[model samples]
Target chain A: MVPQEHPLEQLLRSDRMPHIWCPGCGLGTDLGCYLRALSGMDLDKVAFVSGIGCSGRAAGYVAVDSFHVTHGRGIPFAIGLKVANPELTVTVWGGDGDIFAIGGNHFIHAARRNIELNVICINNAIYGMTGGQVAPSTPLRAKTTTTPYGNYEHPFNFSYMAAASGATYVARWTTAHTKELTKSMREALEWKGFSFIEVISMCPTTFGRRNGFADGLEMLKDMKARSEVKNFPDLEDTDIGEKIVVGKFVEKEKRSYLEEVKQWR
Target chain B: MSMKSWQNQRGFLFLKEERCKGCGFCIDLCPKKVLRQSEVMNAKGYHPPELYDVEGCIMCDICTEICPDFAIYRYRSKERGKNA
Candidate 1:
C-alpha cells in the first residue's frame, strides 16, 4: 500500500523516493537539513542548482525550480540565474570534489566577486559519485579508490578558504549536528553575497569504508566526538584532522556583485 | 499505562519499513530509546527499526531529524492540550 505523504513531501519530488544514496550516506541527511532550512520561506522564489556528484542529485529530488548542471558548474549556473533574476533566491549545491576540485576556480572567484549566491558544499572528503577518487578536500593519510596507500597531500579547509576568498558568511557543520547544520543553512539562505557553508558529510560506501568507519553511523559518532563548536578560530586552526573545529567562522556585510553592478551603472 | 491507553497519546511514530535501508540512525539517536532494530528484514534485506518502548517517546522528533532516508517521522494528533 502507498503510504501517506510525509510532512516534508511538499518540498520533495515524491516520485523520486528511495534515492540512490546508500544506506548510511549523509547526503540525504544534508538534503533534509537544506529542506528544513527552507521551511517557512517562499519556496517559489528559490532556485536550486547542483553540479554532477552524489550531492548534485539533490536537484532532482527537491520539488523546486532546480537545475542539474554539469560537473563543477553549479556555481556558474547559479550566478547566471541570480544575475538574470535578482529577485530569486539562488543556491549552488555540490560535493567537495565538484566545488573544490574542478569547480575550485569558480568557487573562489565567485566568493572573491562577492556574488549574491548561497553555496552549500557537501564535503565527504572524496569523489563519491565517480567511484571514490582522491579529491582536493580528501584528508591526508585517508584511503580512497585512487589513494589506495593513503592520501599524503594536505586538504583545503573550506570554511577558512571561503572566509579568505571574501564570502560574506561562512560556516562548517557535520551531519551529526543536525540542528546546527539546519540553522546554518537557514542563515546562509538569508545572508546575501557569497554565503558558503561546508557540511562535513560521510560516504560510507567510499570514504568511510575505505578509511575505518564500518558505516555511516560510526562515522557520525566519530564526527560527534571529534567536533568542537567554537564561534570563530584562526584559519590555520580550521584543519580537519583528529579533531574538527565547526561553527560560524565568518559573517560580514559587503557590497554584493549585483549591488556593485548597480552602482557602476 | 496499558497499550490501549498509550494509543490515545497525542503523538505517534511511523516507520516506513519498506523504504528503510536499516542504517540505524533513528535507533542510535532516539533520546527515549523507544526504537530497536527489528530482526525481520524488509524487501531490501534491511532490518527496519521497530518501536520497542512507545511509552517513553516524548515526540522530540530526534529520530525524524536523524533519519537519512526520510523513512521515519512523528505525527502529532490534532487534539489540543493532550500530552505529546
Candidate 2:
C-alpha cells in the first residue's frame, strides 16, 4: 500500500486532489517549502491569504483558515485578521503581478508601517496565468505575450523595494534552493515585524517555452547554475539576466504597527 | 539494482501514480539515480517514475520534497526508527 497516501496528507486539502498547477510548474515546490515551515507549528494559529494568480490557488489547498482574496487585495485582508487577532500568524502569497503590479500600493504602505506579517512573492518574471503578459517584475529585454519584442522598461528589484519600504526582514531565494527557502520561511514565520520573501520560481508553460527553456527541470538547472548567494546582494544588479543574486538583503529588529499603536493608545 | 536491495534501503517510499504529471523533477534531481521513468502511462496519461537502482540510494527523501506533483513520500524503517 505504498500508494495509499501522501506524506503531507494531513497538511493539505486531500479532498481537492490533484492541484491545478501545470506539469513542471514550480508553484508546487514553493508550496512544499511553505508546508515544511508549517511543520511543528500550531495550525490553529495560522491564517493564509492569497491574491489572484497561479499562486493564488495556494490558499485553497492548505488545511488552515486560508483565504483566496481578490486581486492584489490579499495584504489588506490579512491585515484585517492580524489587527482583529494579533496572535494569528497572517501570511499572504501572491505572484509577481499580483503583488507588485496590482497590490504595489498596499505592499509599500504595509512595509512602511512595519506590520507584523509575512509576505511571500513568487516571481516567475511574467504573468503566467494570463498568457505570460509583461509584468512589472519582468526583466529588461525579456519576452512575454505583451512584450514580444522584449521589455524595454526596467524591472523592479523586489528585495530592494521591500527594504526601502522599511520591511524588517527581506530575503530572496529561487525554487532550486529548497532547504534555504524553507529555512527562510521558518525564520519569517517566527519574526516580529514585516518580512518579505521573493522566490524566483519557474513558469515553463508560458514564460519558459517562449524564452527557451524546454521544461521546468531545465529552468531549475539553469537557476542552480546561475544563482550566486550573497548576504549583501547588490540591489542594482537584480535584473534577472546574465546571473541572479539570492540571499538575505536586510534584517533588523523593529516595533510592529500593532505594538506601536497599542503604546500610543 | 534489484527490488529486494531497494526495499532494504527504503522502509517505505510511496507514489500516487494517478497524481503524477510526468515532470521528471524527482528522477532528474534524485541524488542517487534510484528512479527511472516507467514506460506505462497513468489515468492522466503521464509517465510516473519507477525505482530501478539498488545501489547508492541514501533514501534522502529529496524526491519527496522536490516533487512538484506531490507524488513521492517516504517512511523510515523501524530499524532506523526516525520520524517520517
Candidate 3:
C-alpha cells in the first residue's frame, strides 16, 4: 500500500518526519518540489549527484539513486553519469562556494559543453556548512564569518553567468517563489540541453542568527517582500539596491553539449 | 441554514492549482480534515486539494507547518475579534 503512494513520498522516511533543515528553510520546499517532479517521472531513470555542503544533503534525502560526490565535483559526476547512460535523467546539486568557487572551471565548461543535466545551485549567499564564511554569492557589504567587517566583493549573478556561458536553460527563483521554483524545475527536467536553476534559500542558524535575520521564517518573509519579479533586461540597476530581482529569467533551446560531442564521434 | 453555511468561513489556505502536482501531501497532513481532493481538475489538470469544511476550522495552523512549499496560510477571521 505504501508502495502505491507517490514514489517520492514513499521514498521518504516518514519516521524521519522531523527534517534536518531549520524551520522555514527553503531547501525543504525545494526538496518537496524535487520529490513531486520526480514522482511524475520514471523513478528508474533518475540519478542525482551532489557536492559537499548543506545543499549537497539533498542527494541523501532523495529516495532516487544519487551520488554524494566530492567537494565541487558534483557537476562532473552527473555529467559522467549522463554520458554513460544517456537515457538517465541526471541532476547536480551544490552550494555557491563548492560550485561557483572551487568548481568554477567545471561549471563554465559544463555549460559550454551543454551537458544535458539539470543543475540546481542552492545560493544561500554564504558558506553555510562549515560556518557563515564569505561566498562568491555573498552580496557586497554583507557580513560573514570571514568578513565580519562586511564583504566588499561583488556577488556573481548566477543566472546571467549560466545564460551567457551557453547553458540552454537558465533561471533564478527564490525559496519564497515555491510555485515558480517548482515550475522552473519541471521545465528544466524536460529540457534537452543543460539546465540551471539558482535557488536563493535561507541559512537560518548561521546566516540568519549572525546577520540579524532572527529566524528562518523572518528570512523567508524578508526575502519574499524584498525580491522583485522582473524580466532580466527590464530589471533596473537601481532596484538591485532595494531588493534582489527573482524569477524565471531564461529558457531557450540550443545545441546540447552531448549532441555536439556526438558530432565529433 | 445549509451545508454551505457550515463551511462558509473560507480559510486563507488556497492552492495555486497550476503549481500543485497532486502529490497529496496536503491531503494527508491536514489536522482538521479541512482539505480534500477536488473532483474538478484545475488549470493544470491536477486534482489539487481543496477545503472541505471552511466553517469547521479551529485554526490550528498545522497544515501550514507541514507544507514544504509554504503553499498554505492560516488567516484570522474578521469576526474572531482577536486574530490568531
Candidate 4:
C-alpha cells in the first residue's frame, strides 16, 4: 500500500487543511496547478505574495515564503521584494478585483517597467470574499450582492490589459484546464520580465448562485465547453464570453526593470 | 490494452478523509471508475472519496490536479508489471 499522506503534504501547511474556501470554489484547483508548476525549483528562492480576497488565502496554504499583504497592495509589495532581492523568484497571486481595480496602477506600471514577477490573477467575476459584490472584473449586467438589478460597468479583459501594459508574457486559462494552466505558470516563472496569467475560476458559493451556474462542476464543464485554445491569439479577440478564447497571447524577450536599472549604473 | 494488463501496472490511491470538503472533483473527473464518494461522512458531515476499484486506477494524477481540496492523490507503487 502506498503511504497515505497527500503528495502535496511537503508543500502545504497541512495543519491548515480543509481551507476556508467554499466547497466548489476554484481557488484550490488553481493553487494545485501553481504548486505543481513550482515543483523541481529551489523552494528557498520562491517568494509568494497575495492580496486580500478568497484567492489571497493561497499564500497561507503554501509552504513557501509567502506574504498575505494588505488589500490591493500585492503587486507593489511583490515588486519591492523582487527589487530588494532579484535572485528571489517573486510571484503575486490575487483576485481580479484586487489586481485590476485597487492595484490597477501598480499592475500597469510593473508591466510597463518590465518587473521580473509572475502575477496570477484568479478571475471569479465577483468579489467573493466580500459576499459577492460586483467587482471591477465582474461581467457586465451580472447580478451580485451589490448589483441586485444588474451591473452596468464593463469588465476588464485581463490578457489584453497585460499585453497592452507591456508584460513580456501573458496567458489566460480556465480552472478546468489544469495541465495547460500548469504549463503556462511554469513558462511565466521562466520568463525574465513581467508575466501575467489570468485563471477564470468559479466561485460557486457567492458568484455562482447569483449567476446562472447552479454549482461549481456545472460552471467548470461550461467553462471547458466555452474555452477555445488559440495559442498566440489576437489580444482583442481574447475577451471572456460565451466562447472564451484561452491561450498564451503574448511572449517576448525584454530587458527586466533590474536589467535596465543596472545598465544606467 | 486489456483491463488486467492495465491493472498490473496500476497506482495506489491515497485519501485524506478529514481534509476533504466533498467537492466531487476527484470522483467526477477520474478517467477510471476507481473513486467514489464515501457513504459515511467526515466530521464536517461531508462525504469524501474512497477507492472503489484500485486495480482500474491508471495513476494519471488528474484527480490530484483537479481537486479543489488537497484530499486525494495516487501514489506510484513499486511493483512493476511483468507484461508492460
Candidate 5:
C-alpha cells in the first residue's frame, strides 16, 4: 500500500516481507538507511558485495546486482569489482567480526591503499550468527557467550581506525538514528576514494540478553541518548576517548586509486 | 538513458523486518493509508504489512520510511514500466 513516489518504493521484494532478523534488532534501521542511500544514488552500474555474517546477507535483500563472497573476503571482492569495472559503484557489506576482527588486516590495507569503494561495517559488538560470541568490537567488561565472566579487552573504534588508515571518507552512526546514517551513506557512495561507514547495530537476542538489557530497543534508546555530535568546542581532555562522537569524521577530495590507475595511461 | 530521465522513470524501496516489533509502526505513519495489517503471520508470528491494492500503491514506500521495524518495500521497473 506504499506510494510509488517515495524514495524507498522500488528496492524491496514483496514476497520477502518478513525478514529473518530477530525482534528489536537494529539491522532493520541500518538496512533501511543503506537502501535509502542506494535509492538516492545512481545504481545502474552499482555492484554490491558482502562477506560472511548476518550483514553479509544484505546483498540478497536489496535490488542491486550483488555478489555473495567468501567469509571475511567481501572487501577484496568489491576491490576486484572496482578494479575491473571502474565505472561500477561497488559497496562492501560485512559485520564487525568479519571486517574489524577476522578480516582486520584486509580492512587496514584497503584503507591504506585508498581503494575507491564504499564499505558499510555493521558493528553489532558480538558475533550474532555465530552464537553471540564476543567480537573485537565488544566493549570491555561486556558479557557474551565467550566472555560470560565479562571481557577484559577493549573494543576497536572503527571510524577512528579508518581515518588513521588513510581512508578518504569516514563516518560513524548507530541504527537508532536513520536520517543521519542515510545521509552519510549517500555522501560516502559519491566519494571517489575509499569510504567507510561504521554502524553500531543491535544483536538483541544475544548482546542484550547477556548484557542485562531488557531488550534490543532499550539498547537502541541508550545508544540514541548516549551518542553526541562531534564538535570542536565540545572537545575536553577528560572527554577524549571517553564519549562516543557520532558524525562525519573525515571527508576530502583525493586522488582515488582507480582514477590514479586510469591516469597511468 | 539520460540520467535525469532514467531517474524520473525508475524508483525503489527496502523493507527491514528485523526492526519490526510488528507493532504496525508504518500502518499508522502512512498518510495515504496504503498499508494494512496482514492476516498471515511471519516466522516470528508477527503480522507484517499487506498491500490491499497493488495498482493503488503509488510506490511511495513511505511505509518503509516511517516504519520503526523497517518493514515495507516499493520498486518501479525501468525497462518494463509500471505494469508489474
Candidate 6:
C-alpha cells in the first residue's frame, strides 16, 4: 500500500528530507512555521530568498520560486524581486549573522525605505553554519568559538532596531512559540510595507553546547521560560539579555517603496 | 470540565519514528501530557516520543506544532469511539 504523504510535504521539497539542519536545531521549526503560514495562500506568487549560512539553505528546501543568494545579500536580492514584480510575495530568510552582520546595511536601508518584503531573521546568536562564532545578535558574555572568554559585544535588539529603522511591521518570537510565530508570519505576509520577524532559534550542536545548555530541548526550555510576550512594548525596553521580550512590537500602515515609485511614475 | 471528560473521546497520534530526532519539543509542549520519550531507539539513536495517555487529549495538535522534525501529528475522530 502507498504511504500517505505528510500534510506539509507539498510545501517542502521531499527529496531534501533528512535536512542538513542539526538534530534539535530550531531552523526546522521556523521553516515549518513559515511553510504553514504560506500553505493556504497563493504559493504560485510567493518567492523565497536566502543568503549564505545555515538559514540560507531554507530557500532550497521550500518548494517555491527561491534564490540562494550570496552571503549577506538575501535582502537585496529579495528587494530586487519585489521591485521587478510587485505582485509577488518576496521573503528573505537568513540567520542573524547573514542578515545583521554582513547584510546589515541592506537590512536597515530596506526597512528605512519601507520595501515591500518579508524579512525572517532566524537569530541563533552565533554563526552556526560557519562554526559557532560570535554574531551581532550574540548576547553579552555568551561563549562562542571566537568569544572563548565571553561575548562582550552588546547584541542587536532586532525588533527594536526594525521599528526604529522604519519597518512598518516588527515582531519577535522564539521557536518555542510556534503558534504565535506562525500567526505572526501570516500577519507579516499580509502587511504591505517592510515587515520583520526575528525568530530566536536554537543551535544545539554549536551555540547550545558552547553556551552551557545540555541540548536543544534545554535551550528551548530556557527560551520559553525567559520570553515574555508583550504587545507593543516600549522599544527601548526590548533589548536582548536575561529576559527576552517577544511579541508584536510594532505594526502600522505605511506606503511601501513600490507604492511611492508608482506615484512617481 | 468534568462533564466534558465524561464523554467518550477518540483521537489518533502518529509518530514517523525514523524522522524524529528526539528533541523532546513535542513532549515538552503537549498540553495533555500524553507524550513521553520511549526507551526504544530509532535508526538515528534518538528515543522518539510515544503516546502515554490519551484520556485528556483534546486533539489540540500542540505536539505537531512544536515538533521541529515533523515527526509527530494528531487527528480527532468526528464521532467519539466506544468508551473502554
What would the TM-scores of all predictions be?
0.94, 0.94, 0.75, 0.94, 0.78, 0.92
Give the C-alpha miss distance for residue B7 in model 5, angstroms. Answer: 29
Q: What DockQ was computed for model 2?
A: 0.58
Give the runs in model 1 whose Cα sits over 4 Å from its true position.
A1-4, B1-8, B78-84
Model 2, position A73: C-alpha lDDT score: 97
- What digit string (tens of lDDT, one per residue) describes model 4 on residues A1-265? 4466776778889888779898889999999899989988999999999999888898899999999999899999998999889899999999998998899999999999999999999999988887889888888888999989998988889889999999999999999999999999999988899999999989998888888888888889888999999999878887776788998889998888999989998
Cα lDDT tens digits, model 6, B1-84, are: 000111225556566787888888888787778778889888778888877676766767777777777777665555445453
For candidate 4, give the docking quality class from DockQ. Answer: medium
lDDT of 5 by residue, A161-180 (tens): 78778898888887766788
Query: Candidate 6 has what TM-score?
Result: 0.92
Q: How accurate is candidate 1 locally (lDDT)?
A: 0.87
What are the clash counts of all predictions, listed in order?
0, 0, 2, 0, 22, 0
Report how far residue A1 has shifted in candidate 2, in Å: 12
- Candidate 6: misplaced stretches above 4 Å? A1-3, B1-9, B54-56, B79-84
Candidate 2 lDDT by residue in tens digits, A18-81: 8999988999999989998988889999999999999999988999899999999999999999
Q: What does DockQ give for each predicted structure?
A: 0.48, 0.58, 0.09, 0.67, 0.14, 0.37
**All candidates in order of DockQ, best leading:** 4, 2, 1, 6, 5, 3
Alpha-carbon local distance difference test for all models: 0.87, 0.87, 0.72, 0.87, 0.73, 0.86
In the range A37-126, model 6's lDDT, one tens digit per residue, is: 998999889999999999999988999899999999999889889999999999999999899899999999999999999999999989
Candidate 3 lDDT tens digits, B55-80? 76655655543466434445434435
Quality of candidate 6 docking, DockQ: 0.37
TM-score of chain A of each: 0.97, 0.96, 0.91, 0.98, 0.92, 0.98
Per-residue lDDT tens digits of candidate 1, residues A116-195?
89999999998887898999999999998887999899998888888989998999999999999999999989887889
Pick out the ten consecutive residues of candidate 2 chain B with the lowest summed lDDT. Answer: B1-10
Give per-residue CA lDDT, model 3, range A1-265, as digits (tens).
1112222446565444335555446677778766656667887898889899878877777778979989999988888899899999998888898899899889999998888999999888888879889888887888889898988998887877887788888777787676688788888888899999888888887788777876666777788788888755542342234577877666676888778878999
